[model samples]
Target: MLQESHTAVIARGQHWRGEVATEPYEAAWAKEAIFFLRALKVEGSLQGTRANIQISADGIHWADEGSSLAVPTTAGEVTFCRISHFGGFLRLVVALPEGARIQVVASLNLKA
Candidate 1:
């Protein structure tokens, strides 16, 4: 099971990586899942730049699941991403435009 608490940054910058592993491995699989990704805060000046979020079942391979939300610097905070119709163990990876430093928070909800 994944902890309810937020996991901190595994890496920061243009390319960031983070992973959440399921314990008691057999129970991790679910019929449906939703992942909530929130950009808690951003730094290092995000002028005319955007960020991209990606997910992978295995860390080595990744596919663009698409951004659930995008926050232009001029807009308010709280960017989100949602991935539905997924099963098995999962991992998330974030890619920011060059020279962008940002921190995001994410959580997972599973339904059997």
Candidate 2:
């Protein structure tokens, strides 16, 4: 049987936001997991210089798993990518380089 556990809470501020979590299971059960991340309904008059999303297993350590996902918005909502991978732990980090306040919504799906 496959199961999931919430290991962290993700909240976004006016500038940046992120979260991390881990799920333990038999390594032989599955090889990888798929994470669907999105940046939705952002409203503002600021130019987003850059937006980045990344994942990590150790929590303290991280890797640029979802780097190519970025959307520049002056108004309206924008969606990013559907990233899939395998790891013991997982985290989501988003950065807005322009320093403008941004509203973001994100979620993750884990498989093992």
- TM-score of each prediction: 0.48, 0.50
Clashing pairs in 1: none
- Per-residue alpha-carbon lDDT of model 1 for 6-111, expressed as tens digits? 3333322222223222121111345544454444556555554433444556544555556434533432354445555443345444345555555554445455
Number of the predicted model whose lDDT against the real structure is largest: 1
Prediction 1 TM-score vs. true: 0.48
**Which candidate tops TM-score?**
2
Each model's lDDT? 0.43, 0.42
TM-score of 2: 0.50
**lDDT by residue for model 2 (1-112), tens:** 5464331224332233332222322222334443333344454433544444445555567566554445436434544444444455444454444434455544443344
Model 1 ranges off by over 4 Å: 1-28, 44-76
The residue pairs that clash in candidate 2, if any, are none
